[model samples]
Target: MPDPAANLASAMAGAYNAGDMERVILLAAQAGDEADEGILALRGLAEQATGRYDHAVETFRQLAHQQPEVSAYWNNLGVACRLRGDADAAEQALSTARSVAPHDAEVLYNLGLVYIQQRRWPLAREILLDAVDCSPGFVEARLQAAYACYVCADNIGQEAMLAGAVNWPAQPAEQALILAAMLSTQGDLDAALHTLARARLPATPEDERLRLRIAAQRAVLYERSNHLDLARQELKLLPLAALDALPDDASQARAEGWRAHAALAMRAGTWADAAALYRRVLALRVDAEARASAAFGLAASCDRLGRHGDAWQALDAAHAAQLEIAREVVPELLAPDSQPLQVAEVDRAAHARWRPLVAPSSRQSPVFVVGFPRSGTTLLEQMLDAHPEFRSMDERAFIHELTERMEQVGQRYPDELANLGGTEVEQLRATYYRMVGRVLPDLGQHRLVDKNPLNMLCLPMIMRLFPQARIVLCLRHPCDVLLSCSMQSFRSPAFMVLCSSLQRLARGYVTAFEQWFRQVEVFAPRVLEWRYESVVEDLDRHLTELAAFLEVADASPMARFADHARTKRFISTPSYAQVTQGIHPGAVNRWHGYREQFEPVLPLLQPMIDRLGYSR
Candidate 1:
């Protein structure tokens, strides 16, 4: 006859396998102190399955105590602790599990989850990257890493992680849909559309839902790529109303389609249609980010329809939603400590302290376009980019990246700029050009027009490295700038955190310009101020001046900027749609429409307004 203990273990194992968790627990309880490691382990797993996390944690803790070397016991304890809302305990157990099995992917992934649960995004992405390296087919780990990248608004990081999926042998339809959307965000519309096509496999309802998602994303991409006809065709196929027709989880896809339609409607001057579409998206069960974006779109639509009160309310909601996300997910953006690169809260004293220790190099310096956000920098960039003599890269962090290298060596940027030697200067300058080459390969005969709006804060650094570089200052109505900045749903942390409120945004603008004004006094570099209202009033006049400033062969090419824009894969700014519409006074003096909302911020913005020569 079989041993009694062996027989009982076999019975309990059968019960556990059959998902008879209560019976498994009962048998384990009856065995009590007599239960072996196997019985205890099975019972602990059953507790976890039944959501008895506290009981599971205790059982796993006991098992771990009995067999301290067993990685599974420690891992189980970690999972149970995590599910029970004890991140500290989960981390402790997971760290123990990691120590026992250093290369264990499951332990690593769980550790990543602990950080993710706490909203420590950067660390979560790094740990999740470790998990992916430890094991193949850890697709969940990869997806989580991509999500972590997105949370911090690291577009480059997100693109790189999602693109790495190509190394995998195959991906399920559901996974493919997400990866495609990631590519689209990085301005690779063709690649995104291609990936979407491959995701249309006839497998299951989830696959069918995945196809629906693919179509939704494709519609948005089509519109971005300037294939409006196709975008309209794709949108007409969607707009799922019935609960059963669309998955409850298809909120993401549905929102994308709705927002695309809203954008299209706005472009067509159908404010009512745009407002309705935005309301449809707002009604969806989506996250804070999507909600923020929909609200902003609604505000814009309302503004066009002369619903100033509703527009103001929508903007308030949008900013609140974005502020919530930034505060919760990336608190460092609000008041950074160590990020000397992106931690650019520069002021007058800081600007005055800078002295150019690095002598100007003979190497050709790219022309710099500087302004605050929503100040017509993109409009200028596109017009300049339309010229055959100039090329513009997407808004880049190369300046931040360059300063990061300085921070890496325990040197602060402007503070240390006064002390740099020829060797260090050559190294930093080389690094800057190396980054430019990586993006555009060869400028050839064309001059690179570097357009990062906030690079105004880095003027001392720019002037120090390339004193002879010509800079274009795009000036707009201060009130309009603050209003537009508040209305946008920018992904960049600097904008998200700083533009959270009109007061904060005004303070930031004043501070940035104070830094700029001081740099102008100190450096006395060649500068041209292009007032935005003046440019819009006479596009031809500004185009001529721009061509003259850059020494372009023909100003006529700049006139076709709208046509040039449509051929681009995508425009990477909020003005993407507006740029294609040609020169229009729609945004000029738009702050007047929201004058009531601007009243509070007027005192803060008055000095800049008067200085910029805009009427009060």
Candidate 2:
């Protein structure tokens, strides 16, 4: 007679393949003490299919323990653990499977899935790419890799993945949407629209939800392309009533629809409508980024309605939510009191060793615009950008990038600058030029304007790199600057956390300005102290002076800067809306409206206020 265990395993496999999970489990149990690895594997897979993850995990764990060298057993265990929402255990099990079968495509794919579940996008992308390379027919792994690229904002990688995925059998609608989003981000609106149109959404509820999400994303693309009317039209396709009728399980789709509507409302200056819709968005259990975005929109609505107190409270919530998300993304950099103190210390040491080069290099030196946030840097940059010969980069971290590059190459900034041989210095300078060239290419006969506000902390580094660089230090009333900073939502958690409280905002401002004053003493006469009030009150006068300082012959374009600003795209600052609308003198003393709120921080800001020539 045939072996009982062998016959039972064969029956179980046939039953499992025929979707008879119950029969598979029963046959598995009938094997009893004679149950071999094949029978146990069948039982585990049946349990997993039937949503009995606990039983599946136990079965796979026992099988893997009995046959420690079996990659399939470990892979099944990881899959079961992942199904049960135990990412840590899943990662461990999958890691073991990877080691046991280093070239196993299935094992690699499972481990990459676990990493994606853990939000380890970079590692997941690497592993998933390996899985695709090991087995080019792995459609699931390719899609997962595309998702990783989307999360990491690796547009080129995402495009490559989509190109391969399109050739796969039975292409997924989700993949099409991902391709559309990536194309939209790259400013290929026509291609995005085409990709989205080709999406084959099924009649299933899941696909319906995807369809609604695609509509929302298309609206965002239109908005980014400066077609606000078309953006609103796209959003209108998803009926508000239909979105509201979605069940709790479809909360994500509902949230997206509401957020899209709210964005249109905000753009149209319908503050009340935006406020109501954003409130609905916040009520849903959305991701942290979505919640933070809603909170920010609500704050903007409140501010426009003259609800200053409500606006501040909403802004605080938004900043806290964003900071929490930032902590998850960069735990090391989110430590309290780390960034401010680090910058202060580094700049102090760097300034101490500051020296002019023997002769300024022939390369075009960037015009550095540095100051505290909300201090009219954007205004100055936009004015300069309107000129034919000036090209401004909106709020980049060139200095920060250079410093990190120095550390990567076995050299510390400032301290290592003094020890650098001529060749090393040239190499470092070349690296800086290469970075700028990549970001702001085609700078034909135009002076480069680097316009990061927090570059106040990098003054010494700027001086060392480009000794002939013209530095414009934009100044505003300390109280106004602190108030505006506290009100605005910053992308940097370090800055957001520092300005979260009135007291901390005041103290941070003082620390930054103190550094600025010291840097001025170290590199005097090269710095132009441009006041925001002066720029607003006497635009022509200040523009003429600014032109003369930059050695430009004409200041006519500066007068019509707002007109030019409105026509420009890709404004990457909080002041984008404000600058496009033209200068508002009402922003001059906004602190007066929040005087009671400013009371806790006034003493800290008083010295800076006086030093900056602002009257109490």
Candidate 3:
């Protein structure tokens, strides 16, 4: 007593399971109005597999509408929509699916893919991790979560994911490349190369395209790790003369080859060569970060070649690309004006609440190096770090973490600092030192120098925790600082937004310094104003004076600062390259050349200029 529809659906299901997709689709067409949900679902899957995405989407949409409560139907609809390049529709459908079946790994995985497609790294990372939790054997879900981690710069998360992938032998070529990239970023060069080796095993001579890509990536890893000679050897394998019109992934690898070559040229200080290769990278279809880096590199090379006009053009392109990333990552803070800083403008009320306490502890306080970014903080950090007695993690956000903790506890930072008692302050101090130790395992007897430029915004909180913390206030020409901030590619979302334009950068600078001055005039924390120009003018005298200020008896190590800088594997500042060479007054007055660019933003920085003892 089998029903006709039931029998037909059973046949279609048999055909679908037996790999006869064409027959499954044909049988569904013949069934027509008599087709059951099973037959139609099989037909839709077959159509999707057979490159009939439109038909598949239509079938899935019909099923989804017919059974609104079915999570599978909704998930299928989302997958179909995603395949058809409708991200918005896919997200909507997958969100519905996720709601219908909160524990569905398939639904969560699809939604995570959609978020990754939209460059929403945090969401992608979270959702994909959820998928893995729902189904621990979801290898692809875990791998994708790791990818999202790499993009968001969550190195610890990426490393954990990589560590979990002990079954590396099962990894496909594409997955191997991703793993290699993640490994390489964490500075495990040999392991990355080993992964690439696995990807190229049982070699096929005819398909050496993948091999070339492997060589290019290897070159990039070497170059980025500062192994120039090894990078050169790999670069020789790449035909950098022309990139093929390949698909996105293949094309991107080729583009990266040119970029790696360009970065090497930049390191070698061959401006023309670097400029040419960067132009090649720009011509290719690169991701936003790569495009922005190529553009900035082009600008720097052109600037070095005495091509200020070309440099400005490239800088405009670079900043535009950077702002696009900011728009996606931090849309709320992406206003072209300086609105984000206005919230933190220390008014008279906030400053009036600051009553400095003379606190003492057995543990030595970190020397707080604060300033508007690009005010020569990097240079100061490098010089100080060269001394055997001084150590720095170079731009850790300890203060920012403290600010976030305050906000998380329903207390606004700076404004709420006045409410903290001695007990809370001691707890906070313990937390700060614990966080520092996590990054820097052994402080021993060496003084830790916390050199974060944006720490200017958290000076009040810093003083609260370490009432007698020695502050080295690095100062530069306001115009120069603003210009430098505008030029650099900062990692912080708020900073990226603030530096999107010269006007915004100037406004942030003015307000930050204004806040600092207000706190200083009242609280008067132990501070030294080290003018950047004066430091450049007298490196020896200034270094000695700085050593004296920090109470370091031996100023000899400070004299060899440039040599120490050269030995550093990496410096996390735009001035990294500059520190490798001897001190020069080169960047001191370079802002005058861009007087025209600064003309519009000059008045915004005038009061600060006067405050810092700068005539212009």
Candidate 4:
């Protein structure tokens, strides 16, 4: 006869495989004192599969305690804890599992899942990559890695991850859809459509749902590619009624389809249709992010349809929803004290204290284009980029990166600049060059144009780094700047929170301009003030002057900057659409249309307006 313990273990294994959790637990109990590790493990797994996560955690914890060397027991414990939403405990258990069995793909995958739950996306992607490397067939780990890459905005990495995972596990259509979205976001619309075309869908119900998702993504790709009619046709095939008829489980996919339709309508300039579709999406009661996005889309539609009041109200709602979500996820960033507006009285003596120690190098210095956001910086950069001798990198945080590097060396900003030795200054300068080189590698004898509006705050640092660098300051009417900033949807949490209110926008404008004025006073001659109104009203004259400032004679190519902007594959700025359309005088004094809205903030902004020499 077979041994009783062996017989019991075999029965438990059969029950576990059959998903008979009660029978598996009963069989394990019957084994009593003779229950081996396998019997206990089966019971633990049954408890986990049946959603008795606390029971499973206790069982796995006991097993891990008894067999301290067994990685499987620790891994199971970690999985149960993760399911219970105890990321800290799960991470501890999984890390211990990894320490026991360093090469175990299951352990690595579980640890990566824990990181994902904690929102440590980079770390999650790194460990998940390791998991896939150890076990190439690990489809789940590969998918998780792709999602992490998407969150980190690593489009290339996301595409690569999905490409590697696509052939595995019967080529999941979900992964294909994600790959297409990543490609589209990276401005590779043709490749995105091709990816969707090559995706294989089986006859299963799940595959049917995936088919809808694929169609939705395809429509978005068409819209982004400026094929509005094709996008509309694709959307018509997957109508909102068809999406609504889907099962409750497909609610997310249904909502996504509606959003895609709205985006297509928006692109087609059918504002009413877009508004209706966005309203339907909102009625689905999706998550805060989706709701915020829909509200923003609705606001845009209303704005296009000449419903200013409704547009402003919708924008307010969108901002509120986004701020609520941001508060939960990144409370520190949304904190009132996070970005304190500098309103200290200008100290001429303090400004004069930090003298430029580094002399102007004979080497071609970089051009810094900075001003308040929405003040024609992108237009200027695009025009400058049109010149053959100039290569302008758009809106990079090189100054912030340099500040962080400076802090890393145990020094504060302007205060520490005075004490830095020649070698330290050169090292900091080299660090900046390395950062710049990463974005623009072949800067051989060409002038580098770095355009970041917020660099106004870091003027002292910039002046110290490159004493001869040309600083082009873009200026606009303070009211127009405030209105434009308030209307646009900024990705930065700080900007979103700050610009949400007209009062805050005015205060921020005042603070930023005060700092800028002080910096201009400190660093005269190097700073070139260029007005947005002047540029738009007299493009030819301004372009000529701008070209002259760069020591480039002909301004002919600069006048056709919009034609060049249209050819650019990627532009990471809010002015992407505006720059492509070329210079428009309509934006100059456009604030006059919303004088009623400006009345509340006029007191705060009028001083700056007059100071900037704009006729009120």
Tens digits of per-residue lDDT for model 1 on 347-407?
Answer: 5565566554545532256888889888988888888898887899868767766776788
RMSD of each: 4.7, 5.1, 4.6, 5.3
Model with the higher TM-score, candidate 2 or 3: 3
Q: Output the better candidate (3/4) by TM-score.
A: 3
**Candidate-wise lDDT, in order:** 0.79, 0.78, 0.78, 0.78
lDDT of 3 at 310: 86
Residue range with the least summed lDDT across 10 consecutive positions in model 1: 337-346
Residue 24 of model 4, lDDT score: 92
Tens digits of per-residue lDDT for model 4 on 1-616? 7788888888888888888998998777887766788888998999998899998999999999999899999999999999988999999999999999998999999999899788776688788888878987777777777777766544445655665342444445776776666655545566667778888787788876787888888776665554557777888779777898899878667877988988877766789998998888788867766778788888878877888888788878888876765554346656555553323222457656664575655236788898899998999999989988888866677777677667777787767776677788888878878767755778877888889898887887777778787888999988889878877766555666777678878888888888888766766637778999888778898888887777787989888898888777557676776788888887877677668888988888888888889867
366 Cα displacement, candidate 1 (Å) = 1.0
Which ten contiguous residues of candidate 3 have the minimum total lDDT?
200-209
lDDT of 3 by residue, 372-435 (tens): 8899888889888898988987667778778778888998877778887777888888888877
**What value of lDDT does candidate 3 attain over all alpha carbons?**
0.78
Collision pairs in model 2 = none
TM-score of each: 0.84, 0.80, 0.82, 0.79
Candidate 2's TM-score reads: 0.80
After superposition, the stretches of candidate 2 with alpha carbons farther than 4 Å from their true spots are: 1-59, 70-76, 95-203, 330-341, 344-363
